[model samples]
Target: MDAIRIQTSAITRPSINLHTNPSGISFMKDKLLETDKSVFSVFGPNLGHYADDIIIVFKCEISPHPDANFSIQAATSFVSGNAFVLRPWLGKDPGSLDE
Candidate 1:
């Protein structure tokens, strides 16, 4: 699982890259394909006129085989907030609530 924090005002398209450690094998954004094998759901706060920042969360499975790293890059659109990847959280189960 990975959490990507995107704080930008402009609407843009994002791309992800996956890499394998030890072997130093990596898959570029264009090389890796997004298949329907996995489905992801994103949850975030509604942007308002007064809102200055937003947090976008991405959830995905990580192979237990070890040596796996991913990166995300977005196209130009609206420039404002910075983007970064958050470390995976440990312990405590997420709550289940559907609004």
Candidate 2:
């Protein structure tokens, strides 16, 4: 019982006080959505249909996450992986400036 209480307290305290604070919640939500859009832009219009499902799922899963760092990291990885996979067909590398 004592161990369980200690574990629970440890888990809840940081999350409640640090991660899930009300004010930062809104900012995290916006940042996640903005990230989704920014990554979508990199893929461009031709891949819209293909990437739409990815964006929807990413938003639904990560938008409510309380840890801002984890959420953004997940978003970045997801977008980067998808972008890398689709780059060949998109006809341009992600780093290139050419139109």
Candidate with best lDDT? 2
lDDT of 2 at 83: 44
Q: Write the per-residue lDDT of candidate 2 for residues 1-99, one digit (tens) a residue.
A: 999999999888866864454332233443654542333323223432423233223466665677523321334433345544544554444553221
lDDT score for residue 47 of model 1: 36
Error of 2 at 98 (Å): 14
Extract clashing residue pairs from model 1: none
Model 1 reaches what TM-score against the true structure? Answer: 0.16
TM-score, prediction 2: 0.28
Runs with alpha carbons beyond 4 Å of true place in candidate 2:
17-82, 85-87, 94-99
**Per-candidate local distance difference test:** 0.27, 0.44
Report each candidate's C-alpha RMSD, comma-separated, in the order given.
Answer: 18.4, 12.6
